[model samples]
Target: MPNIDATVTIPADATFDNTLQALRRSPLDFVSNLVQTHDDDIVRLPFGTQDIYLLNHPDFIRDVFVTKSSYFAKRKDISAEGSYLQQMSGVLPLFEGQLSTTYAPIMTEAAVNAHMRWDTMHQQRDFLKVDIYKEVMQITLDIVFKTLFKVDMQAKAADLVDAIITMDVGYGFDPIAALLNDLAPPVTVSMTSEAQAAHSYLLNFMLGLVEASRSAPLDSRSLFSWLLKQQVNGQPISDEQIADQALKIIFSMHEVTATTLSWVWYLLAEYPNVEAQLHTELTNILAGRTPTFEDLPYLPYTEMVLKEVRRLYPSVWIVGRFVRDNISFGRYLVPAGSIVVFSQYLMHRDHRYFVDPDQFDPLRWTQEAQAARPEFSYFPFSAGPRQCAGRDFAPTKDALVLATLAQHWQARLAPNQTLEPYPQKSFTPRYGIQMTLHRR
Candidate 1:
């Protein structure tokens, strides 16, 4: 493997210090700046003893995520180890297969039920002002709980949501922390007290569900029941393992989907033309009725809008992998033990791939246009074998939710508020999106 040339390195001097400060202040902006400043497909950053390589081009991204995927592992030293879905990598096939089938109908029902709830609320008033993120989060939480555990979680929704939020804050990524971990011997990153408490609450909650399922009649459709049936070697998986898996699944399902849907609402409010076009399609197709999974195929524009939103504000904005072996991008070598990262944020907005990249245009997702772009250029769910387990489930739910909501109501951004993307555990709206809903 050949050494990377000086041109690819982001110099570790005053400029690097300034870049680190920029990173601490705003990681998204830091990455965006890096993309704009560096022309190379692979840019190297010096972090302590470790070299961090940012893969900018789709070809390089394809090599890391697909072709030479065996040479890399999820970077446990950074935040990848904390990822619930990543931790459950082995069961990804089950999620893609059996769990997807079980989840689809539940997701549709939940979407319809949410629409009905909004309908009941709309009866008292023609318009309502609400925080759209909170509204979407609650809906997604309910859907995840019912689908995963066959339990209605509405009553416990408030506390559960709080717990998740606390955990997110506790587990928020810090590059400095990561650098320290990289330089020092391996150690567990301690969660904040509040986050630990939240973790315990969630763990206990899942454990209770797992224990209850032990005595309850086994349902082939239930995720827990299915897990209980599985044997590792000759022994059945323990309650603790089942509970942990359930907790991870619940967290991954709700948070990512809710964040994505929240962005959809905010983006729609900001781009009325796109929203109008979406409403037109929904009206033409569903005719003021709720959408079902079957109706999603005919709702191409609705799907396009969701795709566009994801492209702009992907829930999982950044992915990191630890290089296990020397990997080459042409003549340049990314040495073993270095961290390789790719940003969906930067790739989706690259000028070479997307014309007027900042614009919220659903037309870019048309089959013809999509076919013209590199397959790795717009992966909001990441890519290859390790792509999101809920890839199929999420889009269907989002389209149905958006279609159902758009058929009857329009959400407008409230006046006098700045909308910014805060890249936390997920790309979240820094200030929650406040919107006024009108009867459409």
Candidate 2:
């Protein structure tokens, strides 16, 4: 019946150029400062040249991601025309839901192998002191490669993750590099030569897989090979397109899932009581058996712990989308081409939706609590048509890994390892979460 006022914040006497310079200096700090002194859920930030809006409530999130998602497009600054870049992206056919079901055994085997590797590491040293990031990345890479390409990435794992880390969020969001990556691609080669090499290496690796798959039998299980059998509109997608999709699938599947599991281990280590409960659940439900996809239905606490971990530290801390058409929110008019940003980090911690929002209480996810919350309030993998292609796959993989690892070992924080969340494209530990593995 009436218009609601939106909270607006801007730098005193700010200019566009100065805003860009400020963000370049420290994205994390700029964001942290933006939220200070905020009393409302919707905060409008006119950051230099960007029309940034951070939607902190579930109602706004539903307007952006689900109810009116068609009016928005995933942000593409690196691929925008006038922004010194121009490109579009696509993914392989296996990215859909039905194909995800095909990777059940692949996901389970990777978890088993990680346990074996932990044993090997422990035997080599009195106690296994390891970075959770390194171990989880290896397991994710193994599963992605094994399921998608049927290749063993064991020896090449280091190089692959190294490149992925750099590309995903290692170098914070840089507008300078964004423009240069488009206009003068050679600048990255000169300024970040090692990164360029890793990027090239991964590119060549994908091209090789596609080339090799061309000669393989028609019924091969590899996704690249499987793509060769399909026709789109009575014709097959081009090899180049398939290669692009191959790389897309690998990047999406490996980086985000691995990062999330690393955080999960860190959270488990921090909350010993929670870990004990988890260990009990696995022991009672699994009874010394390996975790399988069918075991997914039987592991309720495992699911709750995962849901809680994601609530605290969503891999996709914040995501931005470009409004394609003007949209209206409560007393707000979001114009076409403006950037609408939302943080899962903020919404998940909102005291309105969560009780003791900062506390790690997996019990908060009991059926009663879950049903009481609004739908879009807890979307770690996002929601709507453009939601994560691997949404179903990640939890399956996480449960399998958590079940298998908790079954055989308990991880405790090793001394001198300080864990802090570093927000990037995906949130990551500033330094990897270090822990000592205790065999069960």
- TM-score, prediction 2: 0.84
Off by over 4 Å in 1: 1-24, 75-90, 98-102, 170-200, 226-242
- State residue 414's C-alpha deviation in candidate 1, in Å: 1.8
Which candidate gets the maximum TM-score versus the true structure?
A: 1
Per-residue C-alpha lDDT of model 1 across residues 339-414, encoded as one tens digit per residue: 7878888999999999999999999999999999999998888677566777776787788777777787788889
List the pairs of residues colliding in candidate 2: none
Best by lDDT: 1
Error of 1 at 102 (Å): 4.6
Tell me the whole-model lDDT of each prediction, alpha carbons only.
0.76, 0.71
Model 1 whole-model lDDT (C-alpha atoms): 0.76
| Candidate 2 overall lDDT versus native | 0.71
* Reference-based TM-score of each model: 0.85, 0.84
